[model samples]
Target chain A: MSINLTILGCHSATPRANAFPTAQYLEINNRHFLIDCGEGTQRQMRKYKVGFTKINHIFISHLHGDHFYGLIGLLSTYGILSREKELHIFGPKGIKEVTLLQLKISQSHAKYPLIFHELTSKESELIFEDDKVTVRTIPLKHRVYTNGYLFTEKEKPKKLHIDNINHYEEIDRADYNNIKAGKDIVLSTGEIVPNSELTLPPKKPLSYAFCSDTCYKPDIIPIIKNADLLYHEATFLADKTDLAKKTKHATTKEAALIAKEATVNKLIIGHYSGRYKDITLFKDEAQEIFKNTKLAEPGKVFKII
Target chain B: MSINLTILGCHSATPRANAFPTAQYLEINNRHFLIDCGEGTQRQMRKYKVGFTKINHIFISHLHGDHFYGLIGLLSTYGILSREKELHIFGPKGIKEVTLLQLKISQSHAKYPLIFHELTSKESELIFEDDKVTVRTIPLKHRVYTNGYLFTEKEKPKKLHIDNINHYEEIDRADYNNIKAGKDIVLSTGEIVPNSELTLPPKKPLSYAFCSDTCYKPDIIPIIKNADLLYHEATFLADKTDLAKKTKHATTKEAALIAKEATVNKLIIGHYSGRYKDITLFKDEAQEIFKNTKLAEPGKVFKII
Candidate 1:
């Protein structure tokens, strides 16, 4: 199985004519999730061919307008589309109050159940888990209450060696599950076969970490260590470290340093300040510390191996 | 000297790839105003070349998400643009609370003063007035609190008759203001020139009425009588009259009937339902009852004489 991420928007502060604010769509093991819906996110989803119906879960990084302003509009559109499936929302506290107030004043009755999971913890905690993957909150240091998410795929069952299994007469279709589960095949002749002879180890589980709108906090490196892919916000260049520190946002050098310390396989940087017209400077600055650095361009997709 | 209206969006419900929700920019006697900022309205303004700085006043018809969801985004953009002039907003009572709460959560401190005028009157009342134009609210019948605005230009000064002024020795440059103000010119030689002889009558004051998301209410006809141009929402066709009534929206026939009864100079029907692929059917249905009917196409500008 593979995890794919599509960059929906990656600009900072305000949406400009050529740039959009922060939004991303992640598809992991056939499950779709929307992360940090900024203004015009629904339109961006439509423009990028991402179906809203597939987005059952939405994670807001913070309450900032550039992070979650499109949420209300997206919910309203779901009502218009007559969506009946329950929607799951995970964000900081006060999201429910803000959203419900707008819906109440508008007199819009949602046809679907809205489930809210407000995160208030300042520590790393497991937020969601299922058979395929597990999700946890990575508490981040920002001007507001913010939490980044870490997704890790569960270990899969060992693969069955078909040729080895066929060579044994006792091993048949009925024993396929046991062989895949790393169990030895029991023969009627009372001969023992080790599990290593019939099965191989499961492929290494993949992991991804998303961090945005936060300062350079080295504490998170341990939680996100060895991730296959890590998306970090690089709001400013190293020359503007003072402004970045004042705003509690990370600079390109800081993001790259975090990725290097975490030993992540790949690093993607985005959320560029509106002042910088050329985004190439961010990639250039980030590559100074990390070799496998990439820019999170809108509509670009990243495949996690 | 001229009133121009540019239709930014006209679709009724959720925004789609091919259709946008309600938004309009009206330039009346050199005053620019924005009516009903739906989602993505700022982008539409940019696409239509409507300067956001010129729009000092914004009038929201209702609290519906399709009507005012774009307000907060626009306000944030203004802060990013460093607007120092005070911006005025006129809407229902709860608008200020809703808008301010979002701004507070986003930590967006406006560089300009945001003046809010909460309208609660159920009768036609002048909400804004200046030397150029007067704005009055047209109470509408809807499921929620809604108000349509009526903009009327104030009476202008008479135009000077340059040839007539040059022929008379007493009517020099000093007497130009008195002649334009409809005052008779009195000379030192005791020769009296009537105001009508020295200047021509001022052009007739123009008026425009904007109504949307309201039911068929005959009570507003008198308030908008003989309007130079009227924009009324026709959300559905005559066949969907029952649906329109249930939803508190107007049908094409109902909108046309209102325009005919009010004796408006021109009628523009908009807010077309997404179910209807061909908008020509709405125009045809409206024109059957009102001869001077037009469709409010996005980006189309209407000039009022």
Candidate 2:
């Protein structure tokens, strides 16, 4: 299964006319998951036609307005629609306070259950485990308590060539099972059916990691290494290395360094500072270290195979 | 002078697709004032080109999410824009708690000073006084402590007919004022300049009263009666009057009763429930009782002449 990522917003602290705040929609095995929810995200979802009902989990990296300002609006809307299914939100400790306060002040009694899973540690650990994927936190170096999420799709079942194997075709259930298990099948009547002739391999599971608004630390290299798709924050250009260090933000070169050291299949760098009018500098800087580098633009979609 | 009102959003409980919650842009003279802030207001402002900088004063009708969900985003954007002018906000006591906390957590300090005028009473008292207008609170009937805003534009200065004045007129400033005030004028040259010939009567100031998410209360009629434009909450249709009363929200028919009894020049009914997909029923129901009823549709402007 391949993972498709859509960038809803890719701006830093300040929201610009061209670039919005940080938010992305990741679709794996036809299931939709939201990464971050910036302000005006509902409108973005509407514009993109991403069905909100399909989204079951939202992973928030931090408490910055640019990161999760649109969360309350979305939550209240879910209540207004009288949703019955539980909405799962995974974030830091203070997230529940902010979310609960908004709901309480609105006098909104939700018809659906709201489940919150708070991440407390700065280490690699599973925050969510589901039938299709597992989400783990990757410790990130930022000004405040923050963690990036790693979504890894579960292993799919073995494939069977139904078009070739039929009930009347002498291939029994045991023979089909042997073919599905990648073994040579010998029928009861001394007929042979090779595994390669009856079945193909199941698609490989895909994984995507989101690391933003953080300094490039080598410690996360092992955790995110060989990820199918890795998005890292490149808030500044190479010339502003000093400013990046002072602000604890990553420069393009540093983000590129992480992608290179981790050997990620695809590197997408974004969360650009508004000071740089031309974002091509970040693209140029990151491309120096990583060959498959792309600048994350708002509303752009990328596929990881 | 005429008062112009634009319905930016008009839904009560929460934001819905195409039916935004309580947010409106009111304009009198050269000023623009935001009455309420529903979610996605900045996007609505951008779509309508209602310059955010021109919004000097924001009057929040209540602390409900439908009324104030977009306040922090607007304020945050103002901070990012480095607005130097002071922003005067009028709202309930919890408003400061809502805004200040978000700013604190996000570490976003505004470059401009935010002056919050907390409304904490049920009396018809003067809340905001400016050069061109004076604002008073009309205590409303709602589940929470909600108050409606009465924006009354100051009376215009009478025009003086300079060409009609005598060349040898040696009238003092007080005499000119008296003449402008419709008093008889006697010139120094033994000539009489009648007030009728010297000046025209000042036009009456136009007023717009915003009755936020509240039920029909006849007591407020004395304060908002005969307003140039009156916006009342019509959260439900005539069929759901019981639900409306139970929720402390006004039905379309109920809102029209108040508008008709108050003898308002023009009535705009809004704060619609998301249940009704079409809003024409609300206008028809209100117009059945009040002839001059109008629906507050998004991006539509209603002028008070």
Candidate 3:
């Protein structure tokens, strides 16, 4: 199990020539997902050479313009492209109304089924689950109702120990499925062979956490504990702690503190305020508390092996 | 008076890298106006160095995503920048509901007053008039209710013929105002001087007509007659005349034909369909019918001096 994340945009607030707003493309367990599509995200996707049709699910953190303004344009483009795959959108309440209204008014109706999964719960809850992965909300504190998301790969089936299986003549090729399913093999001589002896353990499952536009909240540490990778919003530096608090945004140090408390393997920080001319300051400040911190940039990718 | 028009984006349908949707910045008679703000228009304005604060009026041709998707983002950015000037948005019906609903749902209220001039008229009518310029809607035929705009500079006062005015010492400096107003000058000796003898006519007024996303409709020739410059949408070439007619778009020949029949001084064609790889084909085709035809490109400027 592995996760690959591509940062389509990472700047805060309005989009500029060189700096884009928040948007990320994540590939986990062979499932593609788009998070927080800001304006110009489609262009960024095109620039980064991301497979446009690979994405079947989209998760929006909040309704801020910097977070989700590009949604209508992308949806309309999908309609223009005549996408037939059903798209599932997980976002806060009112996303459906606002999106459908624009499409209806413009008469650019979608050719595919648009399923909206409105999230209103303030508690951590499972929002999506498939055969290979599961996604749950990491309710976050912000100026408005918001939620972070935790994506995890489901545990795979046990691998067969071919050498051990060779010792049993009763274990035919047809019994390999049972062995992989953790079932014991009953010998024809009325002897039992343990499944543990016939099968080896599967690889460990990996998890990714995405948190943004939220204040410094330690309550989320339990939910994101021991994640393989965590992307958190660091809108300000330590010097702007007061401003960060007033705006309900996290500072670099605050984000590092969350990373430390959550014990994630690596931390990716972004959603930078445009005031800072040098983004290296964010990486330097974050590294002071979390050694495994990295700064997010447009088109930058992070992978968990 | 002069008209300086900056084409922010000119491609049709969807926005792509190096190919933006329809948006233009027009500076006429000291008035700055933004027309058809598609997605990424704010970034285009920033890239082209168009003064964001100078635009008080915005004209939208229709509700298509490629025509006006960037409006809400721009309005939100204006609020973020603490814009104090009232903004006037002129578009078709349902624009207000769609825009206001987004602001309401996102809670991104504008600090400045947002006035919406909903146009439902199917006839030519004056929509905006100021001290120096007047804007009138030229009802267009399209898939949706669309209207092109005509911006004309009001007639300026006659310029004083300094050498001729000195011929009459009795015509004091105080009489200059009446002379410029095209009134006969009354000398101190009660001798009347004809206004034409004391003042020269002012520079000829300049007018610009913006027509986009419309099929060939000759009826608009009367409204846009003798325009100094005309921008018409030429989505396809003459080879795709059938497709153009079916899509309610105009071909290169059709746009040039309109420019020729309307007797406009110059013709600028844009909104090129993505199917054409070489935009020069549009210009070459248009120039075949109109000698003074120009192709609209991103950042291309057309001026009437």
In terms of TM-score, the best-performing candidate is 3
TM-score leaderboard ranking = 3, 1, 2
lDDT per residue for candidate 3 within A218-265, as digits (tens), equals: 999999999999999999999999999999999999999999999999
User: Which one is best on DockQ?
Assistant: 3
Kindly report the TM-score of the first chain in candidate 3: 0.98
lDDT per residue (tens digit) for residues B3-78 in model 3: 9999999999755677889999999999999999998899889899999999999999999999998898999999
What ranges in model 2 sit over 4 Å off? Answer: A12-20, A29-32, A109-111, A156-203, A215-219, A234-257, A272-305, B12-17, B172-197
What are the fnat scores of the candidates, in the order listed? 0.57, 0.29, 0.59
Clashing pairs in 3: none
Model 2's lDDT to the true fold?
Answer: 0.84
Best by lDDT: 3
Worst 10 residues of 1 chain B by lDDT: B12-21
Ranking by lDDT: 3, 1, 2
lDDT per residue (tens digit) for residues A1-305 in model 2: 77889888888866444557888999987778998898877767776777888888999998778888889888987886778898889887778877887788777756799999888897789988878888899989887778899999987766887876764367777666667768866767877777776776788888899997798688999999899889999999988989899888999999989999999988999999989999988889899999889999877899866
Q: Candidate 3, residue A188: CA error in Å?
A: 3.1
Name the 10 consecutive residues with the lowest summed lDDT in model 2 chain B: B165-174
Tens-digit lDDT track of model 2 for B18-85: 56677888888667899898776776787777888899999998877778888888899898788999
Query: How close to the true structure is residue A85 of candidate 2, measured as C-alpha lDDT?
Result: 90
- Per-candidate TM-score, first chain only? 0.97, 0.90, 0.98
